[model samples]
Target: MKNFPLLIILISLCIACKNAKVIIDDPINFNDQRKNLTLAYLKNRYGIEKDDPTIDPRMIVLHWTVIPTYKKSFEAFDNPTLPDWRPDIKNISGLNVSSQFMVDQNGTIYRLLPETIMARHVIGLNHCAIGIENVGGTKNLPLTKAQLKSNIWLVRYLKEKYEINYLIGHYEYTLFENHPLWLEKDDGYRTKKTDPGTDFMKRVRKAVKDLNFKALPKN
Candidate 1:
């Protein structure tokens, strides 16, 4: 797959989404500026030294922010600085740390940072992991059909573009604890996460079946 051209598509998609308002009923798109921002985020947040030919993305880790809406989620990640809890990237860059994408309850997929760049969504495998955050994982507000659909589309997009092999939920990331870390630079470190849910990942896996990727049964 042509990763670079797909990136161009993603950038155009991000550009198209700039004027978009979060409407649960509508299919939201993305824009170039947003795409570039995500790419820039990867560079600043992870301090990726250079692309590693061997660093094949093995999994797509699903997450949830427990936040309310898309606007709120966007504002949260768009902050040029990450919070103190993000000690993982404290030494790398002052840029606020986080995942590659955020899936809103309304099913809007917001790109935070690019997939190629390491995101802090999960620890132990930040370098080879791609994090997808879904908004609204709270008591009253659960993930919606719209969010699920958007997540599926985004997952398929990534798998095809990056030749992604595994898919798992944030709750299941610990399963990769023994897997070798691949930062392509850093020695790697442990990270913590417990967002999103199993049922959610099952649904995502089902959605990406055509890609020939399957979710690892939870241990």
Candidate 2:
């Protein structure tokens, strides 16, 4: 009977674990390029055109900022125009790439846009994918443990909130080239990428394997 209080505390902790981390709303400039890309994404994603900018969010695509710090990452995304370096991609949507959420090195998650909105993070799957960008992934700066935990929590939270079908790393996105989720309009718009590497993704998948989401189909 004396252990009843301990049991109650344990139960309370379990309930608390169910609660999600706070997602800070740190918006980027929703410029004209972003607006047009949103419509284009909607058209490709749903095969119909609507006035609003939204997505079905069939997949979650993870990325790494490669920019070292969170503020620099935000600055890179804050610019309305696509970076001048990628002429191939800018011609298609003029919209600079961005993600729905980003996890800082310390595990703090920031919501750059709504969950069901389109982001230009992945090439072929942007129309139906949710992008989660982490702060670091350079050769010198690897991702941290805190970021991993935050990503696990974030992925689970998103899965519960939406009908997420697949969870993939940025590098694995090309594997879906002929699959139904691949919706990029321009075939030539593809770029070589290696952000948020295999090891990070393996850890994330191992943590969230119980969610029972479908694995990437065999190519």
The model with the greatest TM-score is 2
Off by over 4 Å in 1: 1-56, 84-95, 182-192, 214-219
How many angstroms is residue 200 displaced in model 1 relative to the true structure, after the best TM-score fit? 1.2
**Per-residue lDDT tens digits of candidate 2, residues 1-219?**
999999999999988876558899999888776787678755763464877777788899889999899999998888767888768777676678899999999999999988877778888777788999999899888999999999999999999999999999998888898897776666766788887899999999999999988978777
Query: What are the C-alpha RMSDs, in order, of all predicted structures?
Result: 10.7, 2.4
> What TM-score does candidate 1 reach?
0.64
Q: Which candidate is the best by lDDT?
A: 2
Q: Model 2 shows how many backbone clashes?
A: 0
Per residue, candidate 1 scores C-alpha lDDT tens digits across 1-219 of 669999999999998786343423221222444334435545543554443312347788888888787777666666556667767666655545457777766666666654565554664555677888888888789888887877877776777688677777887766754454433234454455556776777787777777886545433
TM-score of 2: 0.90
